[model samples]
Target: MPSTPSIPPWDVHRPPPGHGKVFLITGGNAGIGYFIAEQLSAAGATVVLGSRNPAKAEAATASIRARVPGAQVRTVRLDLADLPSLRTAVEPLGAERLDGVIHNAGVALDDPPREETREGHELMFATNHLGHFALTHWLMPLLSAAPAARVVTVGSFAAKTERLDPDDLQSRKEYVPKRAYGRSKLAQMYFGLELDRRLRAAGSAVASVVVHPGGALDSLTPSRPPVHVRTAGARLRGAPAALLVQGKDAGAWPAVRAVLDPDVRGGELWGPRVFGLRGRPRRERVWTHLTDASAATRLWDASRDLTGVDPGRLP
Candidate 1:
């Protein structure tokens, strides 16, 4: 890992005017994703929202259209829990060259007992990691065709407390809901860094970066009683915690910076400056272990096996 990772400064709250760039944002119908789509559209980019609910997707785009009257926005169906649905979702947009992908869709499984997806993987890992993995693989061609394309994935500060458990990648043996979610988010951050390494090694032009909201308010993660209790406890300790930290628009800033900042590099991480709890967008270095080459190689192999998609073969 570089002794000092490049941390670019940017005004994420206010993006510069776009020149008709094409952007695809998953989970764009609500919360952070919705705000990201809205901001990008307002900047004059052609926005495509990938959502599971047709009504929600339509509503999201409509809302953006209302605000940015004539904003170029479209909607597509995407269900991260179902691998087959992901494949079907990308087919329609495969032909178009994409400028960037904001992998904002994810799920936090707080339910008791471990749950699996249609592909038999742990629910949290499936939705948060594998789903985005498969989507990025399938869309590689579109990403590569662009002059300069980017792939930004949302991770979390909770990743610091979690490590990838190869033995229980699916959380089958020991299932701790919050821990599982953290592990999955950790996997995402790892994948983003590792993908950047591989892309540089393979001489691919696509740039990959990861961002964390640093305790932003997200609807994607469930806010059950236990979660709230823990959050309250943190606040009592002067930790500056919230059941959900930043507002929806503010939460989207880190990701927006990672995607739009011209100076961003592969493996770079952007997040809030304050104790990683909540603040404005700022580039920050991730833990050294996350850049472990060996772990990344193992993860790449595991992801390929799980998704049955070879990213190397992508255009």
Candidate 2:
């Protein structure tokens, strides 16, 4: 693929104004997703928060409205783990075109015995990878309807050194909570790149970009009332970690840039600029593990088999 020409670095504070665009962010009710919504809303984009909990989504919407005054924000009930409901989950999004979709919602099991969704897929893999994959299939029409649309997949720094086992993608043979989580995220990154490749081949206007939030610590994050609260003691304790990490708000910069930056191209990776951990967003080279076209294809094929949806077919 041809390399994208270099452009001026994006200023997080002054993102290109998004007055007329509409963006849907899965899991936008809290954490980094909340910050992504807040920033884009501040810039005048109609931001929709997709979450399983309506009340929490409302709280996030309220927080953004309070902070951004005339911000246009809405909420849609979405449960990625519940595959059958996804088609209906997006019904509220309407027939209007969608400018962007951020595949940011995910689940991480810290310890385990491993769990499975009602559909019998591993919890982490189902929610983190397959759910977004299925959702993309449903949302393609809305996305393609736009003059230019982008899909930003939020991956994890944990997946940097993790490798996926094609034979055990669901961790059926052996399931370690942390490792399972990492593999799930790695699958998401693969999907983003693969989706982009398919888009380019099909000559679609929509773009798919991937990003990772580097060391986003809640202790260092600022409070947003009902959405999140960081105590003074927490701030003091996290001050030391600040040298190498950033708050969730800062962690959201890369995804926001991927969505709004006109110069950003598909099949590219974005992350924190400083040591890939604690600075402004910068376009990073695609990781080696993520560059394996064969693995990505296998994963894509497996995802389609599991979800029964082919995202490559656009409307």
Candidate 3:
């Protein structure tokens, strides 16, 4: 394992002005994704808020504009669970050049019985890892075209406790919801790191960085009318529990760091500076599984085979 130095403190509110940059954030309709989009658009970036539902995305965009007057925000329908939905969702971005893309959409957890995506992969794996993989391949050129573009993937602390069975990448033999979720997150981090290495080797200016939002809860978010989030969320966030957990906006700091921090290098993994669950962004190491070069390569190859799309054209 290579040693990595700790990162400096990051203030998510202090992102550099993004007047000329164009950013795309998947799952921007709610949760940390929405907050990230809010912060980015407030910073003056022309942000493409990608969501599975057009109405929800529009609602989020309106909320952003209401909060940050004159913000440049557009909605794009992106469904990570469906490949066809991804294609239709990405059509609008074909002509708009992007300076950065954040793969932030994913299923946090699900009950057992391991469901399969439309593409016939494990549901968690398909949404959390493969969807981002295929999306990246689709946008590689536009990314490479921009000078020093970045790809920031939102990973999770679940990676630390999980083990990936490379042989059964799809969880066919066994399936536990949390374990499956953790494996998917680990795969995301692995893919991001491997992409960084590949882009660097190819002498491409694009950088791939992965980050995890600490224990962020939806309860901390202000109510978005018409959508009833788990009401229990607000209760769970009460009293001392609130201190340990971070709000959705604060949880987005690591990803915000990955997106805007100029000093951040490719292949770096960043998360909360305090206990890996709260505070400003700090550099961290993921499980050795994510650092295993061979495993990453296998995942990358498998991704291309499944998606039938090659990201090789970028370099």
Query: How far off is residue 70 in model 2, in Å?
Result: 0.4
* lDDT of candidates 1 onward, in order: 0.80, 0.95, 0.82
TM-score of 3: 0.91
- Candidate 2 residues lying further than 4 Å off, grouped into runs, are 1-8
Best of the two (2, 3) by lDDT: 2
The top-ranked prediction according to lDDT is: 2
Worst 10 residues of 3 by lDDT: 221-230
Question: What is the C-alpha lDDT profile of model 1 across 179-200, one tens digit per residue?
Answer: 9999999998888888887788
* Per-residue accuracy of model 2 over 1-315 as CA lDDT, tens digit each: 999998766789999999889999999999999999999998889999999999999999999999999999999999999999998788898648999999999998898788999999999999999999999999999999999999999999999999999999999999899999999999999999999999999999999999999999999999999899999999999999999999999999999999988989998999999999989999999999899999999999999999999999987
For each candidate, what TM-score against the reference?
A: 0.87, 0.97, 0.91
Candidate 1 residue pairs in clash (backbone atoms < 3 Å): none
Q: What ordering of candidates by lDDT runs from best to worst?
A: 2, 3, 1
Error of 1 at 10 (Å): 2.6
Supply candidate 3's per-residue lDDT for 15: 81
